[model samples]
Target: MIGIIGGSGVYRAEMLEDCKKEEIATPYGRVSLTVGSFDGKKIAFIARHGEKHSVPPHMVNYRAHIKAFEILGVERVIATAAVGSLRDDYVPGNIVVPDQFIDFTKKREYTFYDREAVHISMADPFCDEMRAISFKVLKDFEHKEKGTYVCIEGPRFSTRAESRMFKSFGDIIGMTLVPECQLARELGMCYLCLAMVTDYDVYGEKPVSNVDVKRVMAENIERIQRVIEQMLKELPEGRSCRCSRALEEAR
Candidate 1:
């Protein structure tokens, strides 16, 4: 099975066939998601932010969503996030499949093993196979094959000074992806983030706005959907990446 975790501007799984709304009970809370199929692969999708974009990034229930996918037997996950570009060249309307991430988030659960010591490796945070497949499928699009994501704790955009600091080492900036990505690794689930650039961060001397982010994402939503669809059709059934073995050495 496959999973799609939709972030800002992505509220539904319109590509899934025979879709049905499902609500699952998890240790954290109940999670609402849609279940369907495409290309014979069962898909489960949940909006990272609530459907109406009411849930702020810092307040997202990262655990319950991952737990819901686990309960539904989802193996690989493709998540979408709208981000601000840290560099001038990584312009809006482009897609970046991040190979690394720097977690700057605070006050969120970073792991599921709070009761025990389980240190999972995040050296290469994303699933390599999924990254490779995404690169291939998005070849024709204006996409970056690799980049570093800086996930911040936010209900607000960054200050100019803060944006400049992040620009020193990150390619893109967003409010989600930390605990969500790491938690998936703890459960040995293959995860990938398809980050879409919405605007220039304040480091570029242009202030970020919710209006601009929504506009960019709204224009390119179809492109994102097509990329996921192609990936679903190309994804193999066997497990070959280290993602499924993520917890083998974690103790």
Candidate 2:
């Protein structure tokens, strides 16, 4: 089964058929899951910030969430993230499929290899196959095929200086996707995130604000939903990458 993790303003996939809510318990903690079928294929959905958008980036139980997906026999994950644009090319209301990522997260649980020192390769963090499929599905839109995403540890927005400095590091900025992306790799599950630019952080001429962030996300969510549904429908089945064998050597 394929799994979908919803970010800000994307609580559930209203387009799914026969969807139901269920409770799941993991080694890390318990979480709620929405399961159903999309285009005749089984899919499991999870709200990254809870169903009500309550959890913050630093506090999210990424380990538990990934663990739950594993237990449910999920093979690949399609994650949605609301991010800030750090470049002019990636403007607000654009949907980006980041093929590279840099971690700026200050505090958060990073891995599940607590019993041993496991160093999984960070090269090409997102699934290449998934990223390719995403671009094809969203080709007509203002889509960026590949870009660098800097994941910050935040419930707070970045300062002007901080945001400006990050412009050198990545094309887009987001609070989630750090442990979330790395954790999926450790579990050998294919993972890819669709980064939706909600605003131009502090790098833009206009100052960043929560109200503006919400407004941009709200406006572009429907388009994102369309892309996601098409992605789920058109994604090719079976293995095409090393994502499934991520722990082959590390273990």
Candidate 3:
């Protein structure tokens, strides 16, 4: 099964057919996921920020989310996130399949092996095979294949100076994806981010404004829908990568 984690303004997939909600219990907590079929393939969808968009990034139950996917027998995950662009080339209303990530989050429960002190390798965080398939699905779309996404600890957006500092190191910025990506790796699931650029952040000369979100989302909504549709259509049934073997070295 393929798992889809939806971000802001994307709580549910309209393309899903015969959808039914399943509330699952995991070792971490409880999670409600929507199970449905897309093009005869089983796909599970979960809203990372809750169904009503009430949960903030720093408060999301990353453990339960990943655990729920694992319980559902999901082998691969396509995570959609709304982000702020740090680099000039990562413009607003663009889609990015980030190949690297830098985490700046603090005081969050980032691991599932706290009791046993297990260490999971994260040298290559995102799954390469899944990333390649995602890029191929969006080949004709205005997308960037390689970029470093900086995951911040935020209920608040970054200040101009902070944004500039992050821009010096990364190409895009977002609140989620830190523990979410890492936890998926720990659970042995193929995870890839489908990052949607919502703004240029506060460092841009044009001054970040609240109005840009609606504008960017509206302009790119159709494209995002198409990208998800195409990705589902092309997603493979079996995994050939090492993502599922992540726990082999855990101690």
lDDT of 1 by residue, 34-118 (tens): 9999999999999999889889998899999999999999999999999999988999999999999998998998889999898
Ten-residue segment with the worst summed lDDT in candidate 1? 201-210
Model 3: per-residue Cα lDDT over 60-163, one tens digit each: 99999999999999888998888889988888878999989999999788998887978888888999888888878888888899889999998788888898
| Lowest-sum lDDT 10-residue window in model 2 | 201-210
C-alpha lDDT score of every prediction, in listed order: 0.93, 0.89, 0.88
TM-score of each: 0.99, 0.97, 0.96
By lDDT: ranked, best first: 1, 2, 3
Candidate 2: count of backbone clashes, pairs at least 3 residues apart or interchain: 0
Which candidate, 2 or 3, has the higher lDDT? 2
The candidate, 1 or 2, that scores higher on lDDT is 1
Over 4 Å off in model 2, which ranges?
none
Best candidate, lDDT: 1
Ranking by TM-score, best first?
1, 2, 3
- Candidate 2 per-residue lDDT, tens place, 191-210, comes to 98998998889878787788
**Which residue runs does candidate 1 get wrong by more than 4 Å?**
none
Roughly what TM-score does model 1 have, to 2 decimal places? 0.99
Cα lDDT for residue 203, candidate 1: 67
